[model samples]
Target chain A: MDYIRVILTIFWKDILAERRTREILSAMLVFALVVILLFVFAFDLSPETRRNTAAGVIWVTLCFSGTIGLNRTLSVEKDRGGIDGLMLAPADRTALFFGKALTNWVYMLLTALFVVPIYSLFNNTNLFSFTLLGVIMLGTFGYIVTGTLLSSLSLQLRSREMLLPVLLFPVVIPLLLSAIRATSILLEGGSQTELNTWLVLLFSYDLIFLAISVMVFDKIIED
Target chain B: MRNSTKTSLMLIVVDILAASLILTALFMVFYYAPVEVEMGLVQKIFYFHVAAAWTGMLGFLVALAAGIGLLRSGNMKWDIAGVAGVEIGLVFISLSTIMGSIWARPIWNTWWTWDPRLSTALIMMLIYFAYLLLRNGVEEPGRRARFSAVYAIVGFVSVPLTFLSIRLFRTIHPVIIGSSDPAATGVFEMSTRMTHTFMISLVAFSVLFVALFWHRVRLGVKLALFEQRKMEDFTGED
Candidate 1:
């Protein structure tokens, strides 16, 4: 019950701040839309040509915009001493992880939500499939699980803004690649078997890192 | 200070053993390994190629273990060992990757193929290269050790997943002679003498790896001590 409260409190905190500023979400949404526009011009992708290429463009946009929000979100905490205050709280460390992860997940998903409608309007293609949304959830789960921890660590470093992506992109390639591949399968209208294998892999990855970070995060966060 | 001579002696013996085994393995590969009528001399490269990769994997796994050990125990020496293992692993894996490429060029008809295993090996190499870069960016010893240890452990865990995911992707490279598939792609039969030579090469390379790792560890220890002693000298603390 207490853990649930902490998570909700943290989630509410992030939401209120974002509501006040509207900076992070706006930047992420615009960035994602521009990327879609770039994809149209760069590939000469007509509506007819967009179906096959849509999944890749959407994922790429999410990854880039998601990274921007992640960096800014954590930087806000660090700058305002909010992270230090959270550390002083007498609760479990994993709660903090869950809280941050939940909020970041929300930010990424919300970005995707906006991106999808804009993409559909611009490209005139439907991306509202159940299977594709499932892929996004699982993929974004894996991505943010690693990204939240990485962004926290990168915030401590000197070249933080630049370092987060460098430290992250290579390590998280398995998630991104698997997710993209799995998403591609769903977008192609393939059966569950084709999607099941990669989904299983993503589930296992999320489990492994979730456990590891929960255990070791206290160590990393120690002064 | 007194251990330097003994360490050097051990390194020499290991190097000599590695040299003999490599030469004998080459001779047996040419004469006794029984080249396939298909791949001819090119297939001979597979023995050392696989061995180097295995050894590199061994080095990486140990480094990861040492990194975790350092973090848990807070022992500076384990941190040194972790760094040494990663450096040597990086070197051997580089050799393995280059040799794999050379072998692949003739066999696969290209300098590189997105063959799953080979691609994983290349990506793993890049991950550690970033590992070294991370270490370089940190100035404080304690912080560097802690951060690098965390990275090594996380990075190592991700390696197998990366390889498995790629292998799951699609594989075109043939399983070699001694691997599981008897009728696998690029498969061939090996004679007794060739087996003997390959075993010797494995043993020799194992010795060489230990020798190199130990020397590198010693260098790390000495450097740490040097930094500490320099700090003490400046402070006039006995």
Candidate 2:
């Protein structure tokens, strides 16, 4: 209960702060839209092809914008001297990990909420399936679960914004591959077995990395 | 610095051994092994190519252990080992990729394909390369080691998952160890002579990887010491 309360406090603080500025959320939304726009131009994302190409485009957009959101979320804390204050507080450090991850997870889902509709509208293809949205949600959860830790790890490094993506992209290749593939199957419709493979892979990824990050995150953020 | 000369002497001995073994393996690969029937001379690349890729993977595995060692012990010595393993891994893996690419050109009639093994090799390269870049991004030595160690573990764990996801898609890369894929372009069975050459190449590469790991660790130590001394001597002078 204490751990949960501490995590919620930090999560609440982040949400309140973000609500005021909406900087991270807005940035992610706009960036995601632009990436979709780029994909529209670069690839023939007509109604027929949208099923195959849109899955990758959407995930890539989420990843890139998610990177931006992750960097800023941490930098905002560092810039405001919130990190030292948080450290001094009488809370379990891992609570802070959950707090940050939870917040990023929200922002990422919010970004996805916006991108999916816009994509469906532009392509004239219905992407409003419950399963597709569920896949998006699951994939986003895994991405942020892994990204939150990495963004924190890379946060303290020089040229951190530049460093974050390079640090992150390789580590999440599996997650990205699974997410894109899973979404494609949901959109285009595929064999239940293949979908099961990717969804299980995605779930295991979320679980495995979430455990690893919680164990080691304190090392990165510790004084 | 006290044991620098002694260590250098050891490095020289191992270096000589590695060089000679590789030379013998090279001779056996070309001269002793029968010319591959289907691919002829081009198939010769398979020996060193696989060896380099194996050594590269061995280096990364060493780094994973070094990473764990550093986290558990808080020893910076393990940091040197971690960096050295990754550095050597990076070089060798990149060589393996290029060599594999060249082999693909003739054998697969394409410069590249996203077969599970090939893509996995590429992702492995990127992951370790990012490991090196992460090291460069942190100014504090202890923190850098800790961060990179964390990442090395993370990166190492993700690779197999990456492999599994891609493998599920379908692999056209040859599986020489197990049953080969029929759809795979360049599958081959090794004759006795070729197997002998391949085994020798593997041995040669293992020795070379170990020797290089030690040498790289030594060089890392020297570089760290030099940097520390230089930092100490600096007094904010122009």
Candidate 3:
């Protein structure tokens, strides 16, 4: 279908652009690493404490670094007048939203993939587990879905850099809380019953925001 | 001019009604409701605390409705109502949080705890604060309204999920009048007079919310009109 092609075209365009420059990914990765290092010194945890706090540290890092990627990606589009170009394309606006959100999700996942290994190395906790990965995927999906939508709005603002997180963090609390709980449980070998609720919460949040952002995308991007 | 006078008259009538009801509710809370035996006078904050919180929720619902209105109709009046609701809601939520904290110190032995309701309310406050900030950062009127309405709807949709996640994860806040939760800490029985006072206070606060919302909307209308007139004058000169 033309819609599918449109979405993929946008996705591939971002991939090609990133492959060329590596600007957004590099900034996100570096910022993520710095946050982890800062947390390491700030907490100064023992092995036992590290095991308990590792989930918190990873999420906090992702959240802060994720903001960098989101702000930069959207602002680039705005800066180059790429959004106007996309608008003039012969495609449904929702397809454009999907394309951007999918690319954003890939960026977030890639950041998490890089962060997890480095985090495990630093903390001596093997975070490369199936369960933790699942939570990270769901959390990152919800985060980027909402973040991409908000960043589009924020990019048009006078204080785009500061405005994104202010608009984002609070709305993303449920997703973050659920992710943290599930991650902590997996790390600590907690019972399955305890983890199930948080997983469900994450799924519900993803569904709700995904549907909302899709429906409202056309409205916000209207010239 | 006729419409303005009519609106002013209606506002005056609503103002008197809100004022008298609030005063009567205060009288009932202080005089009619029996002093809570265990928490003593500190428990009196409960009537106003709960009332302010109800008003806050009401204000948010107004914003939600106004958000939908704006999206459906593309009218600036809906945008005005949306902003007015959020501003008033912010004030009342702040009041409720402060008063709840004041009540919590004696009851919970801590200034604050991560009780599900308290935490969700805090997050709600932050979200709306960001809403106001988002509105402030935009320059163009139409674009600002469109962006803000979308954000308001998005933010409103997230609130229930936020509350649900917190409530399911951990809950120590009391369910005052409803479900029986053995784990809830602050549960207390209300006497008949206390119930009466609570109900009256809720009604009074709802009326106050309406009056304040209408006043705020009028202010927004006046602001928009002044800006429009100024722009017209400048354009005419050109």
Best by lDDT: 3
Which pairs of residues collide in candidate 3? none
- How would you order the candidates by TM-score, starting with the best? 3, 2, 1
- Model 1, position B29: C-alpha lDDT score: 67
- State how far residue B71 of model 1 sits from its true place (Å): 2.1
Proportion of native contacts kept per candidate: 0.27, 0.76, 0.91
Interface RMSD of each: 1.4, 1.0, 0.9
- Top model by DockQ, which number? 3
lDDT per residue for candidate 2 within B1-238, as digits (tens), equals 8697887888889899999999999999889999988989988999999899778877888898999899889999999999988888889888888998998998888999877777777788888888888888888788989998899888887455433533354667776766765677788898999999999999999999989888788789988898787777885453
**Candidate 1 overall Cα lDDT vs. reference?**
0.78
Compute the lDDT of residue A90 as modeled in candidate 3.
Answer: 95
Ranking by lDDT: 3, 2, 1
Q: lDDT of model 2 at residue B121?
A: 73
DockQ of 1: 0.56
lDDT by residue (A143-172, candidate 2, tens digit) is 887888999988888876788888788778
TM-score leader: 3
Question: What residue runs in model 2 are displaced by over 4 Å at the alpha carbon?
Answer: B1-6, B161-169, B235-238
DockQ of each: 0.56, 0.79, 0.86
- Among incorrect, acceptable, medium and high, the docking class of model 3 is high
